[model samples]
Target: MFCNQCEQTAKGTGCTKVGVCGKQPDVAALQDLLIYALQGLSLVTAQARAKGVSDAAVNRFINEGVFSTLTNVDFDPARFQVLINEAVAHREAIKLRAGLTVDNPAATFTPAATLEGLVAQGEQHGISEALEAHEDLRSLKQILIYGLKGVAAYADHAAILGHEDESVYEFVQRALVKSLENLGVDELVGLCMECGQINLKAMELLDGGNTGTYGHPVPTEVPLGPKKGKAILVSGHDLKDLGLLLEQTAGKGISIYTHGEMLPCHGYPELKKHPHFHGHYGTAWQNQQKEFSEFPGAILMTTNCIQKPVESYKGNIFTTGLVGWPGVTHVGKDFSTVIEKALEMPGFAADEDKGSVLTGFARNAVLGVADKVIAAVKSGDIRHFFLVAGCDGAKPGRNYYTEFVEKVPQDCIVLTLACGKFRFFDKKLGDIGGIPRLLDIGQCNDAYSAIQIASALAGAFGCGVNDLPLSMVLSWYEQKAVAILLTLLSLGIKGIRLGPTLPAFITPTVLNVLVENFDIKPLTTPDEDLKAILG
Candidate 1:
């Protein structure tokens, strides 16, 4: 098995033996096969769409199926076999419905009879085989595929909240088919850009779903301290799952604490209103091994970014949605098992005041103070704005983000989102005239909020976003970050600094095209980059 779809791929290259994410070769092969099956489904679905016979079930399944293959989402080979089987079932159903037949291998592909057979078949359809093309073309195809995975994740999240866009699904199917073609560098790059634009739409729908379901996030203070009571730690990026757990656990004496990317849930009015909803725990996904082991209660992984659970607390961890582990308990809507586990475990014995951090500075909250922000900018109170955001990983050199934020001029306002802010989230940056210097802009799922805030600020100042006094210093760890990068480029945003390292799949030739076209730069030292941006 060879996989390099994430920032932490083994040795900065493909993971050949086992995934650095703890995915075994069998699981990796199954994931590859699942994706191969989905491509076939997409081939048929694209034709069905052309015949005006689109199915919502097909669209939703494709989105969820594609999302499951993303790094660190599902590590269960059995689950992937089930998904592969379902993909073929869906493909066949759609083919019969549309009364059309296609000769493409992907369109006519069939799943193996058993799990072992599926894994064997999957090995034949791995990433290396899929991209048996020119190096530059393969690089562009990898970018497109990763970006599509991100789009699917966001689309699945939005669809869960009843926010469905037919065009987004249409684009997903079309792009899946496009990846199969022998497109030139220019055309493949164009598809990558198009994937970015589609991701923007998916994020928009997600923004609507999140803000629509939970009232727009308002600025709120969340504790990093411990509370005395039964506890359940909710991780990953699913607000709906978090909300349901919060509702079910209410009055059961269970205190639900946010973990990892779930830290921003405290800002949502509906979620926060739950009296038992407690504070945040841990930092980011990569630190979960130490963090999860130390947690005093049960853990529920709602979506992606799940690392291998340690033996000590592996039994205490439960997974929901598409996230799965071979031995961890998989949960459904009813979280009684999670609640029971929390009840059986020892929760915080005593309350402790461990200070707090501000969150929920999403678009609504930030833009509501547009006047003050504009005044601060005009009065020279706010010299510049730095959007230091993206996923946080366990790799070395990530300290660059910590140092970058630490060295950001006091006069500049720092807008951050996602787990990357964990580096300096607790810093005492204070506020300029009343606006906080460091603004927490929700989760990576809420990137649309950051884009909206920047667009609004630019609108108020009568200039393009690049013309604003803002610089983006981003750190990417997975496919979601890839999609976000594409969105920024698709919007014609420039001069963005990205690190800790460039993606292993991005050949130098492809990197040159990005540098030449979008002015994208690899990050240097914080001091050097700060000076470059400020000057």
Candidate 2:
């Protein structure tokens, strides 16, 4: 069970025995098998689409099955088995519907009846075996596969809010089928770029879904402190789940606090309107073990970025949607059980006066003040902008981001999104004139908003985004960050500084291509990088 699909893979190589994300070997094998099943399903689905026969359920399942194999999304072997079985069923149905017969191993694959048999079969299809191609080709395939995982995640989120795009689904199936081919470097790279382009559309759909349903995020100050009441912490990036939970727990006296990526939800007008909606708790997902143990309430994880729950808070933690652990209680759309759990537990006994952080500086809120921002930049009051954003992990070099933000000059504005901002989110960076020096542009899911902000700013300045005075210093932890990076690169955004570590799956030859084509570089010390960017 070797896996190197994430930043924190064991020893920066591969997770051989157990996953760093607490995924057991059996669960790992099951996830591998699930992906194998999806490859087969994708084969059949691609054929069906060509024959003018497509199933919405199968298309949706393709995204779900792929998303489940992402880091920390689902860790239950039982769940993976269910998904595998469902994938086979979908494949068989699609084959029958399309009246086609394909002889590819993936197309004719069959799952074992028992869980042990499934795991054993999965072991044969692990990443090491599946990607046994040339070094460079394997790297490109890894990038493509990981990028697909990220696209599936965003697409799934958008579909949940009633936003659907057939092209996104079509591109997913086409790419999956292409992965099984003996494509060359140029062709595979073209597919990777296509993945980025499709991801842009998926993200646009997600942005519309979120802003259309909850209204554009407005500049709002959210308290980081506690409220005295029955409490429930909502984490991850699902706004709909949080909204539903807010509605159910509103009159029941439960104070809902946003955690991790959910912290940005406070800026959404529809969500913040709930009077009982409390402030944020905890930092990033990495610190959840310590933070969740300290929180005196029930916890709900809506999506990815879930860690192995500690014993202290394991019983109180409930998972919904795709997030799952072996023994933790899983709830559906109705969160009555989560509400009851919060009622049963002792919430915050007293209120605390911890200061608040400003959020909801998404595209709409930021663009709303475009006139002022443009004036400030024209007046030379603002020097440069730094889009310091990405995922945050517990790796050692993550302190680079913390120190980098602290050392950012007073004349520049720091635009941040995702959990990476947790490194220096609480800092009082003040503002350049009326604009805050630190602008929180919502969650990782809100990368589309950040891209829009940059594009709008570039348009106002009559220059390309690269010609603008902005540098992207990104830290990646999982596949979603990989997807976002591809999106940036596909847009011809260059000279980006990515660290704390490079992906192990990328060989030196492949890394040289990125360096030559895109000028992508590994992050150095904060002081050196700061001097280079500002100078």
Candidate 3:
């Protein structure tokens, strides 16, 4: 299985054996086939739309299927088999209804019952297909595909909150078909930028859904230590799951604590108001194996970034909403089993004093104090804005982000989002002109907030976003960051510093294209990069 859809792809190149994320060959093959089938579904749907017919069910399923293929989300080949068959059925249904002829191999191919047959089909439709094309064109195709994966993930989150944008779904289908065409490098590059543009709308929809449902996030202190009680540790980025668990566990002597991306949930008033909704429990998702095992409670994984469970804590693991492990219990919105397991486990013997970290500086929270921030910038109280954001990884060079944050000048302000903040979130960065020097934005999905805040700052300065005194220092580990990066490029925002490494899928020629077109580059030493930016 050759896969390089994530930051940790083996040796900064395609993973030809087991995935760096622990995905086995069979699972990788299945995911590729699933995407291939989904593309077939997209072709039929795109054709159907031309005949004034669109299937919302097919659109929702496409979003969900793409989200499941994201890193660390699902590894069960059995599950992918079911999704692939469903996509085939959906494709056929759409074609019959629209009276359109199915011309693509994906639309007419039948999956063999045996694993050998399935693997053969997947090999024909995998990234190797891109390899058969021109190098630059292949890179552009991969970029567009990865960006859509991010869009699907965010759009799924919004759909959970009863927020749906048909236009985003339509763009996804159109782009999928576009990527398969015999387009030139320039056309494919244009399509890649379009994916980024649509992602901005997708992020905005998710932001609206989250804030609309949970209320705007306010600056709140989330304890890093445990509280004394039975607890349910909720991880991943699904606020709906966390809210449901909070409601089910209320007054049951169980404390619901956030983990991973859920760390920013404390700043939302609606979630924070729960008397038993206690503090955070662990660090980023990468550290879950050690952290989850030590904690004496049930663990609910709501979405992606879930590692395969170790024996010690596997019994306590429960997954919901598209996250799955081979043997872990999968639940619906109802988390009764998770609550029961939490109650059955030994409660925290005593509370610790690990202090707290402040989060919830989403767009509204930051913009609410726009006047104060603007005054600080004008008076030179705040000299620079560094968006130290994106996914965190266990790789070596990741320490650059932590070190960079440490050495940032006292007068500068830091805006961070996603799990990357955990690297230096515990550090004591004080306030600047009444605003915290290090402002914690919401989750990775809250990249929308960062974009909004940057645009607002540019407006105040009477310049484009790139002309502001702000620079985006991002560390991407997965596809959501891909979509956000595309969104930035689509908006013509340049000078983004991305690390710990560039994607393995991007050939050097394609890398030069990104460097030339968007002015994107890899991170240098923290000191060197800082001097270059500040000088």
Candidate 4:
């Protein structure tokens, strides 16, 4: 189970035993196999496109396959195996549909005599195949795989909001087929950059979907304490789920508290309008085990970053969407079970603080105030736009984020979200034109906001996204972050300093692909990274 597509990979290398995220060997292997089958699908789809087959079906296959492998998305091996089988079946069906066998991962579309070969192939020893590749080649392959996983996640979110891009899907299928062949460093590097470029479109689509559906995010205050009455802690990056929960529980004496990535949802106009919506409850995703214990409410997870659930709060943890575990309640599109679970739990204790967290600073809102921001930048009141975006982890060195934010030149504006913002979100980072420098832009998905803000600034100043005075200093802990990084790369954003650690799983081949193509360098000291960025 050698997996390392996340910042929290075991010891900053690979998770060889049980995943640090609690993914067992079987699940990891199935994820790998699922990806392998998806490659088959990608290969066939690419071939079909040559013969006039649409990449749309193949795109959905890639999106689901990659998304199924994201961190904390599916720890249930049984479910993942089902997905793998389905992907293999899809490959066969694609061959049948296209009137072609696509017998192997490397083969083009050709009708199969039986589904037996593909199914038998999937059930075959995963490790024997895993061990056949050169370590570097395997690593580069995984990098492409992880990048697609990231892109798929972004695409999936957009799909949920009804903004689908056919080209993003085609790019994913093309990227998957490219990873299957043994390519040289230069070729692999080009493919990696292309992956990144497509991700930018994926992120934009999702950003448009989200802001279109929920309105822009404003700079709002989120309460850090607990709440009173029947309550549920909602985690992850999905605002629609929180909105649904808030709607079902409206006037029902049930309070919904934002947890982890959901903490930024407090700033959205649609989500914040809920009177029953309570303040944030815990610190970050890593602190859930401590925070959930003895917490007098149920918890609803709309997405990833869910580590192993402890016994005390296991019953309290219910999941919807793609987030699933072995024993947790799986709420489908219908969130009634969440509502029922909320009703069953003791209502939140006597903790009532009616307040709002300022947000709505997405592209539309930020661009609306473009002149003010530009004036601040020109006057030196806003010296820089510091995009402190990405994942948050339990790693000790993550303290660097807090310290970095603390030490950044006061005139800089801090745009942050996802769990990473927990480090400095509570701190006072001064202001730029009466707006707090520490701006929370939704969740990890909202990294799109930072990109939008940068693009707007570039347009305002007549430059590219990378040419702005904005520096992206990211901290990743999961695969969704992988997708976001790919998006940044797809946009040609350069010189991103990623830390507290690089994925242990990325081989030298994959690392070189990223470094050479994007000039992506790891973080040194906050002082050194600051010097580099400021320079």
RMSD of each: 0.8, 0.8, 1.1, 3.5
Error (Å) of candidate 1 at residue 235 is 0.1
lDDT of 3 at 360: 88
The true-versus-predicted C-alpha distance at residue 444 of model 3, in Å, is 0.8
| 1-535 per-residue lDDT for model 1 (tens digits) | 9999999999998999988899999998898888888888999998888898999988999999999999889999888888898899899998899998889998887788888888898898887888746888888899999999999999999999999999999988888888888888788878989999999999999999998999999999999998998899999999999999998987899899998899999999999999999899989999999999999999999889999999989999999999999999999989999999999999999998989999999999999999999998999988999999999998899999989988988899999999999999999998999899999998997789999999999999999999999999999999999999999999999999999999999999989988999999999899999999998
**Lowest lDDT block of 10, candidate 2:** 124-133
| Structural similarity to truth (TM-score) of each candidate | 0.99, 0.99, 0.98, 0.90
lDDT scores for all predictions? 0.92, 0.92, 0.89, 0.75
TM-score of 4: 0.90
Clashes of 4: 29
lDDT of 3 by residue, 283-400 (tens): 9988999999998999999989999899999999999989988888889988889989998999799998899999989988899999999999899999999999999988789999
- Model 1 — TM-score against the truth? 0.99
**For model 4, how does the per-residue alpha-carbon lDDT over 165-212 read when each residue is reduced to its tens digit?**
888888888887777666776676567678877777888888888778
TM accuracy, model 3: 0.98
Model 2 ranges with Cα > 4 A deviation: none
Model 4 error, position 322 (Å)? 1.5
